[model samples]
Target: MRKHAGEVGRYIVNGLVATAVHYSVLMANLELLDFQSAGVANFVAALFGIMVSYFGSRYFVFKNTVESIISQASKFGILYGLIAILHGFVLFVWADWYAFSYSTGFLIATVLQVSLSYLGNKFLVFKK
Candidate 1:
């Protein structure tokens, strides 16, 4: 029980770090770079976050894993690829169709994607 609790805590921390990276890049791309399309900004941000998430999940969140880095990263790529697509769709709907701010859409999409990512990492990518 305690082990699982620790793992959960670490996983959440990793997620927070990755989410921060995601949001930062997203805002920078939109505001600083003046990206016209929310989807494009989101994709760029998600790509950066995916790289961070791969390393964080491998070394910090699932430290006991026996899988090789290549194997784990491949799985992470597959999982995050799908999540990224979902994120872009949600962001488009919320920001473009519903007239919400990009920041608001990002927050909502982050919550959804992070939940799915935790499950994917725990069960599929880093299974014990």
Candidate 2:
């Protein structure tokens, strides 16, 4: 359907922006700053992505004003944080098991997580 296609396109655009912010922070912290733990690096990256996602969805993607900025942001952060944990965990495990580069695994995981996040944000978190 055309409506679904539009939604998917918007989802992809929003996701690309958010993922860039998220993955950039993760890669920078882990590769440049040499963070010892990926979990910590992921946490830091997630915060950055959360801000991007909140504003992007608020104005561009969903075009809906949140009832409470703090509440909406916090709820979104907590929900996405949980999803990120699963995402990072899977990528880390697969990288270790298959002896693939963490960066590669991370990229794949990020795409998956972003799609899931779009669904969650659209249907659950910020619905009208």
Candidate 3:
């Protein structure tokens, strides 16, 4: 019980760091580059976030793994790739179909993605 709690705590902290990177890149693309395409901005941000998340999840969140770095990264990439697709779908529906702002869509998508990511990382990617 205690071990699971510690893992969950670490996952939350590392997830926050990765999410910050994701949002920063997204906002930079939107505000600095004047990018109007939410899909493009989200993709770029997710790429950066995935990189950060891979390291953080591997070393900080699930440190008991025995998989090689390549194996772990491949699994992580697959998981995030699926999650990114889901994020894109949610963003499209919320921002385009429902007439929400990009930021709002991003926030909603982040919640969905984070929930899915925690499960994938714990059971699929880093399973003992």
Candidate 4:
């Protein structure tokens, strides 16, 4: 933790950018694609968001110098895949079942992802 201060800051900045991409695509899917399922829409949006995060995390946030890109990416994929599934579940339950605002549910899920991602990337994927 002591050595990862800069990476944490970079992760926050990169995460914000990734979240922007996520929300944009989520809104577009909900509004433009006319998707009836928030879960599905979120899954799609997460795919895009995770892609952006992968590049940013690899090149910018983690700045991993010792690991192979393939190795990091494989772990990243697994981590984010699990996170995305859980994220969709949260959105489905919060917004779809409970009749809450999609925005609010998305916010909640994003917060969860932020914490999970930081820890996972730090200890598991990037190995910084």
TM-score each candidate.
Answer: 0.95, 0.82, 0.93, 0.94
Candidate 3, residues 23-121: lDDT per residue as tens digits? Answer: 899889889998777777788889999999999998899994588999999989999999998887887677667768989899989999989999998
C-alpha displacement of 88 in model 3, angstroms? 1.9
Instruction: Give the range where candidate 3 is weakest over 10 consecutive residues by summed lDDT.
Output: 90-99
Instruction: Report the lDDT tens digits of candidate 4 across residue range 72-123.
Output: 8899999999999999999999988998999999999999999999899888
RMSD of 2: 2.3
* Top lDDT hit: 4
Residues 91-125 of candidate 2: C-alpha lDDT, one tens digit per residue: 66756566577678777778778778888888877
Off-target runs (Cα >4 Å) in candidate 2 are: 1-4, 96-99
Best by TM-score: 1
Clashes of 3: 0
TM-score of 1: 0.95
Q: Ranking under lDDT, best-scoring first?
A: 4, 1, 3, 2
- lDDT of model 1, residue 119: 94
What is the alpha-carbon lDDT for the whole of candidate 1? Answer: 0.90
Q: Please state the error at residue 90 of candidate 4 in Å.
A: 0.3
